[model samples]
Target: MWKNEAEPSLLEILRKITELKLFPLPEYLSIITKRSNEEFEEDDSEDERDNLIDAWDEALKSSFKQLEKYADYISDNSSFGTHQGVKGLEFLRVMVILDDEEARGFLFSYEKLFGAKVLT
Candidate 1:
């Protein structure tokens, strides 16, 4: 869990994301976050890059094992899991996006559960 929120460099964050899910963010976001904006021409080194990616994958898997306790905390109906574990994961917090199942009677319960301002 700590590693997910660790202050790694930008590139390292992307690499950790790749480690979690082969390709983490949406295509557009990935392109924007990964592209390099440099003045000098850098050579491409396939071996080194591959090694780093592999290292990240191993590190992530290890971290996952350590934080195994909170795996089932999020309900299946929630959109927090497997979806955003890519880059930096934020646990203990979930976005209860409104849905049709949420009728007026359920508003107060949600408000109490999440301390959210439900205007119902």
Candidate 2:
């Protein structure tokens, strides 16, 4: 369902999720969420909501077994390390790259560091 489209909307993703019956997703609430946002407004809330939904959709489509296999391969073959994971360890050469968009979890906020968001 996702292969042909260059980009798919939230409604389309919800339908695909329902069709696949992916466990733990709200199959019944697809009816509610897939409905058009009649109260649409020009604000960050909508964008934030879309980001969360997109994250869920992407996670659902990923294969856990494949991810584990890749993790094992990276552990065996690569020196790649996460920021916190690499702490206290030294390497011959170090390079740092910051990618806030792909960063998940609440450990650190690159948004605040880069001034995209203000500290509360």
Candidate 3:
């Protein structure tokens, strides 16, 4: 979903959460991607790859710090995670990202997941 057009909306939600001072400013907020940096790395020079890896490491560290900062609030609050990573966990608010074009199967279709009445 991150690669899709829904990224803007996702960023907007994060901005609103920060701007509105929601959930104690630092708590109940997290972002997880479906794939890691290594998985995303394509063809690149050694130096370029190293730089990219470093940047990804820094970002991961920052995310970890944010989670630690809000460790207390997370017990009953919400978190953003990929479906694969969130298995066996439950949240008060679970926002699933299902791209209309990407999720076309019977099980994934909007019509099946959310009936026609709800869609309208």
Mind giving the per-residue lDDT tens digits that candidate 2 earns over 1-120? 557643455445555666677754564345344544563322225354665555554443434433443455445542333466444346755655557676764666654443335666
Which candidate, 1 or 2, would have the higher lDDT against the true structure? 2
- Candidate 3 stretches with Cα past 4 Å from truth are 1-8, 24-120
State the weakest 10-residue window (summed lDDT) of model 3: 111-120
| TM-score of decoy 2 | 0.27
lDDT digits (tens) for residues 1-120 of candidate 3: 234643233324454555565754332233223333464353234554555444543444333224443443344342322244344456666645545576544333433232222332
In candidate 2, stretches whose alpha carbon ends up further than 4 angstroms from where it belongs are: 3-14, 19-24, 27-33, 37-79, 83-120
In order of appearance, the predictions have TM-scores of 0.21, 0.27, 0.20
69: Cα error in model 2, Å: 12
Pick by TM-score: which candidate is best? 2
Cα lDDT computed for each candidate against the true fold? 0.42, 0.50, 0.40
Q: In candidate 2, which residue pairs get closer than 3 Å at backbone N, Cα or C atoms, i.e. clash?
A: none
